[model samples]
Target: MRIYQFLHNAFLFAASRMQAAGLEGRKEEQRLWIQVNAYRDFIMATGQVYLFEDYLAGVAPTSRPHVSTALGARPDTTSQRVMALLLKAFDETPEPEQKQSVSLLIHQVNFIADTGQLEACEDYIHNRLDYAPLAIAHFTTREEAEAWLMGPAEPPSPADILIGDEYYTAVYSREDNVRFMSRDYVIEPYIEELAAEGIPPTAPAFETRAEAEECLKSHPASPFDFVSIAGEHYLAVHHKRLNRHTLHPVASTLTQWEEQKRVVEREEARYAAMNTEGEDEES
Candidate 1:
């Protein structure tokens, strides 16, 4: 049922986009689009009836991803065959919980009465009867219509849930406090040269980028560099290899000893960590 609806929607959207792009044969496309909308509007009302009259009364059906995708786009098809098929599916639901879930989903989705119902439309009834006229009730006000569609709004949409603190979080820091996510935090990297110079890495954390760079002026071999957080006074030194901030005292004040001890220590730490990982993997 959803597949058919999805195909219907896909056709509608493709036609709309192409028409917007000023493609040829727009007149025929427009006519088809209108026909499709009429079918869709008629079916939607019928679907609502089925949900209330039949679908919600039975055990719920499962695994309708295709149908969901089609419903997501909200297409309408007037073909008698598709409408009958969908109405038939309402009977397939068997579980109470499934019915409840679907009921909630229908409310959450807020599928309003399609305005296309202004057009007089009918469904073919084959040998048993003649084409039947659709008489769908529509809402007058936008708010009224939406309220009806959304129902009681029990579970609440994500937008409704993400109130003050949950939404509009601050990013970057300044001299004053700002709202920000954890990702907004920038950590400076520790300098090995500073470690060898008896200055502990991660200490004397630079509150400003200029201070870190001034400290780096002499030792060009150092991998740690400063990056300023947007709109934040604090500048952080980032270590390229470690992919992290030093989070230690700023060691930018140290001079280059032209010695290999600190570099050797860093290499040893890397090798040690790698070996430990390898051993863990083997185990």
Candidate 2:
């Protein structure tokens, strides 16, 4: 988008320069005019209209060398040099419409870049061709252009996760504060219960009652407890809330548990509504 804007403005500046030169009867030196004409022909013939869009879409330019040529050959002089180039280019082909288009472009470029040379170009074009240059506000520098040509400071990546001292300390304290499980619970009986409930067993069992107890406490419903017991390994579970019981199942194989809960809730609601209706009729 910015490239298009810049190009559009540059063309306008070129037009203005041509208009000024015409008015003043200032003929460009023959050799310079020839060069400008050739350059303009090359641009008009090969310029990609959607170069910026292609770049953004990750599409490589068909002619890489052309890209370098376009940007690298950018004229350093004021808008006059730009317009002279366009006029010389237009004269070679002698396309009336193309000349007019280039003239208009020069006017636009002059307005955007706010270069003084545009006034001279505009005067030349109007005096010679009886065409008035369109009045345009001066172009201000676009911030995007600056940033693109000169990159900004790097920003940190979103996925970076930084663990602070407080977080480390909390985790460390939790692990350190845990007591050995062997001293608190029986491992063999727990494993037997788990096996009766159809839990699969594991190997490389806990070596001592304390080790088994710690494993059980860490992962209370794990199938490893059964393996530990069958292997004659001691086991333990956390004693802090060992006796506390909850009515809900420890684990469920059903994937639609939430849906099932909702269905049950709906059924209960329907029954309550029917009961309420019957009581009302009785009253």
Candidate 3:
């Protein structure tokens, strides 16, 4: 994700949460207020906070094609106007099973921009454009901002630690401050148990499946192989460009684990050879 988009999305989420906090009670409202203020202080410190007008002018050219076609014809189209059109289009769209106009609009914005222009727009949003609504609070020093953000500190407990070297899913118990690792995908019960005890889930980390169908965003290319142990298998997912391989278990029976080892070695060799050929060509 681009930094600009990430910030914008985060701000929206925070704003929504803040508005919701009002009805939840004083404590919840105060907590949300502090968090929002801290975030705003952090934004102000970055010195990249943008005003809406400046942001529109800066990214408009690149973003224009991704918006409504009629917007292209107008000389005075503003970001607010574009947003209203998008919202209206989203609202008028049919159900999820049908062709979604909102989905199409999202895809257009997400995938159609030229890479150079996208990067330039992101940089412009970060350094030059205006996002003033996000940064409502100010702090004099980094330490002051950090201290204010952290608020009163509690006594530290034992740091959370992963239980073992290998696992498919891990869950942390705050009561014991221990992370339980498992080879199986049965993590939901543990999570529910924790939530019942008032310990909300931290971010979840799951091992990517080594199978042909199941994959990770990091390693897109599939049909992976794995090292089969006594009965278990660990995947051999390799990235040819990076000359790197990730190991994870997959419950598939196609090739021997020995074949996966050979495949990893082959991928490394191919990448090395390509680099060598490129260097030779340059010379």
- RMSD to the true structure for each prediction, in A, is 23.3, 30.4, 24.5
Give lDDT tens digits, candidate 1, residues 38-144.
44344342433233223333435444412333343435643322323333323454655443333333321222212222223332112112221121223334444
TM-score of each: 0.18, 0.18, 0.19
TM-score (C-alpha) between model 2 and the true structure: 0.18
> Taking the candidates one at a time, how many backbone clashes does each contain?
25, 30, 8
lDDT of 2 by residue, 110-180 (tens): 23233233334333333422311111111123333223223443211111111210000101011233211
lDDT scores of the candidates, listed in order: 0.34, 0.35, 0.36
lDDT of 3: 0.36
RMSD of 3: 24.5
lDDT of 3 by residue, 1-283 (tens): 1334544554554454456666666564435333433333333333323322134344544322244343344344232232344455455545552223233333222321321133333333343322211121233444443343345532111111111212122232334444332333222232233334542233223343333224344544232333433445444433332333444434332233345557769999999999999999999
Measured by lDDT, the strongest candidate is: 3
Residue 112 C-alpha lDDT in model 2? 25
Question: Any residue pairs clashing in model 3, and if so which?
Answer: 50-129, 50-130, 50-131, 50-132, 51-130, 51-131, 225-236, 235-248
Residue 14 lDDT in candidate 3: 43
Q: Among these predicted structures, which one has the highest TM-score?
A: 3
For candidate 3, the 10 contiguous residues with the lowest summed lDDT are: 154-163
Give the Cα error of residue 189 in candidate 2, in Å: 99
**How far out, in Å, is residue 117 in model 1?**
13
